[model samples]
Target: MFESFWRANGEEATIVIPGWQTMSYFSDVSNLCWFLEPEFAKQIRRLHGLVGNAVVEDRHIVVGTGSTQLFQAALYALSPSDALQPIPVISAVPYYSSYPAVTDFLHSGLFRWAGDANAFQGENYIELVCSPNNPDGFMKQAVLKSDTGKTIHDLAYYWPQYTAISSPANHDIMLFTASKSTGHAGTRVGWALVKDQEIAKRMTKYIELNSLGVSKDSQLRAAKILKVISDGYEFPNSIDAKFFDFGRNHMRNRWERLREVVRETGIFSLPEFPSEDCSFTGDRTSSFPAFAWVKCEWENAQDCAAFLKSYNILTRSGKHFGAGLNYARVSMLDRDETFDVFIQRLYSIK
Candidate 1:
């Protein structure tokens, strides 16, 4: 049977992620302020430990509207003066779209997005690296070893899907959130692992001024749920037994189905999944949890996105993600039936 990159194989099904339990009460009634328990705080610290560097200290957990808020704060903290000589934000091509957005929002006059690192002239800039990156699931090897520099690794998808239990720390300020890992996007809980004291202090100050020190209640809830997921062990239970395995199988199957759809249809293209090195060993085709990036040469990325929307299928076009406007991103997290539907629609592209 022929396959395309946009479809899911196997059983037809409908699926929604059953991960976060924190948002249940909000449906019934909403309250202005929430309360927190002490134990919950302790557990959050433990969850922080799971993804944190053992040697790194002075870590503080602050609940954000989302990690996006922290990203803005980081930009402001590292912002420069003068519009012409703005602090250049260096990021890999095809990065998280918001890297430039948050930078522009917070300090538009003082900062600008610098796409390539090689073209950079000097050492006075901030590099935002997203490991297990958004558009493509590629993680960087390590940050450039420099004392005057600060690197923030957005490990938003750093859970069992892409990383090992003992993956070494990649950068000074490693960002992690409960959204992608535990499927708790509603909690708006995220933490930054900062190795620099002054930068860490600045982040704390920004949080204090930004949202009044993040809700202790939300932090506690996020921590409590994290402890339950963490169980008595270091890794989350999601990976211990067969949860991670099932996810991997499901994702790989989805990717294969999608690949077949693309190969057979021949309307679009894709990045050949790279071979696994010791640092990253997983199914290359479907290793990513939520989405896969597609290389579409014939259509503008925005036009492609609009075309998919006509079929009632949503996709993230790459125009906003970076310089490339010829690629699109589609999620593999949908149900089998939805994937099949997507594939069927994809076949109609040509």
Candidate 2:
């Protein structure tokens, strides 16, 4: 869908990298901190300022291959290096599916994957709070209230297009991705905004040891894309339409059409989101989530994923997200043709 939009609206957002451009692995004066590209860092701040979705002031930026890397980096940074026992890392039910894999794959002594935040009874822990959560698209908060517990706010879907940007998010550790915000998943670029300098250094160190540093080419491209987005907000008609406006309109329409189809089937149910005033847009708007959390309402269809899979409609089972088998997740960010086919298949199902 976004590719079609880019094709129609002019390709001014496109970036052409020269052969010699960003040849060096180093992005700044210090070779130690190669994870961050100076231009990309500046552009990120500018973009966040224009959108008002995140607070950039007084925060240290740490660039990663993507938010996935930053998630692990945050885990590494927060875990105690000298502790005898491993720190528990957790999120609420229906959380991001990859959290467990990412936390436990290394089998590091610093941290270990703990099931759910509500069930966890620990003093020192790392809680991941994904506002505008992945599967269900609900706003979330940290359930663990211990002072020793650290919280990492995953704000990947907290953009104005996905959800209302009521105010600037000022969390100690926040993660944002270019894939969800700019539809640049191929670029493999994401960033973390850290309030604490020590934590920021540790996260940057994690990136340094993990992959040496992020790709310079990807960083340059991300900078260009972010610059385009920021510039579009300032000069709305420069590219005939702004990126957020286009995305928000497209997502809202898709959600409406999907809801209509599901309602007609009467076998599936979707979560309802309330309308709220978006400070950036200056209007009340409902959420246009990136994924559709569909629940099987029919008594016969206990496993929603299996039911969808029978029709060749692939979906992420809710069991992976710690939910019942009746729930499943479908992407709303697929291409226009794929989305149309999905709607057709969904409507045809009795």
Candidate 3:
């Protein structure tokens, strides 16, 4: 999706890291997240401030392998070790499918997966709030109301390109990743903006023990990419140079096309989103989500995923996200050519 954008504007995004530049295990011995490269931290704050997606001021940054690792670390940090039973981890229905799989697979005594935050009766739980959520692009909050519960905000899709930044998010633990933000999944860099120092430390400790520290090379590379992105916004001379603008345009166009095909076929339906004012874009922009929450309207199409597959269109089953068989999750982040093929395929569907 972003390959062409980078190929054209990657001159300033290059980092020439020498062998001896960042070879040590520790980036800053004085900082609590000792392995977090200063350059990466600086770039993260600068980008977030520029986008107005999250409030990074006075927040502790914990760099991880990716948002997945940071998510697991959050589970590790929030769960009470001395509790009589494992702390239940819950997210709203039609949540990111990976949440339950990631949480329960570990079989950790500290935390366990409990289906649907709305249905969970336990008082002690950790809630995952993925605004501009993955499987379905809905903005969500902590559905479970309890004094003892903690929330981890997965703001991966909260960027201006995906949805409106109505206001800067000020959650207790907010997660952001480079993959969704800059289309740099290979770098595998993600950070958490945690309000509490103790939780930040615990998250950092999990990383320290898990991977020894996030790769300094990866951090440096991510820093360069982010710096270029922030610079584009600060000094916008060309359309090609603007990162978010480019992303927003691509998403909007793809969504418009997708919606058109859905309307044409009368076999599928998409969620209708209301346009909202974006603080960063400074305009009322409609949501151009990274994923489409597609529903099968045809009576014979009992399984949405399998139906798409019959037409050689791959999609994730909504059942995996705790939704009914009628729904399917389609990725809108593919390259331009692939997306065009998908659009064409949709029209061919009976």
User: Residue by residue across 38-67, what tens digits does model 2's lDDT show?
Assistant: 889999999899889899998989999999
- Candidate 3 lDDT for residue 146: 78
- For every model shown, what is its TM-score relative to the native structure? 0.73, 0.97, 0.98
Model 2, clash count?
Answer: 0
The global C-alpha lDDT for each of the candidates, from Candidate 1 onward, is 0.59, 0.90, 0.92
State the displacement of the C-alpha of residue 345, model 3, in Å, after optimal TM-score superposition: 1.0
Order the candidates by lDDT, highest first.
3, 2, 1
lDDT of 2 at 79: 89
Q: lDDT for model 2, on a 0 to 1 scale?
A: 0.90
Lowest-scoring 10 consecutive residues by lDDT in candidate 1? 1-10
- Which sections of candidate 1 miss by over 4 Å? 1-63, 79-85, 106-110, 141-147, 163-166, 232-243, 274-286, 297-303, 306-312, 334-340, 348-350
Top candidate, metric lDDT: 3
Clashes of each: 9, 0, 0
How much is the lDDT of residue 53 in candidate 2? 87
RMSD of each: 8.1, 1.3, 1.2
- Give the distance in Å from residue 30's predicted Cα in candidate 3 to where it truly belongs: 0.7
How are the candidates ranked when ordered by TM-score, highest leading? 3, 2, 1
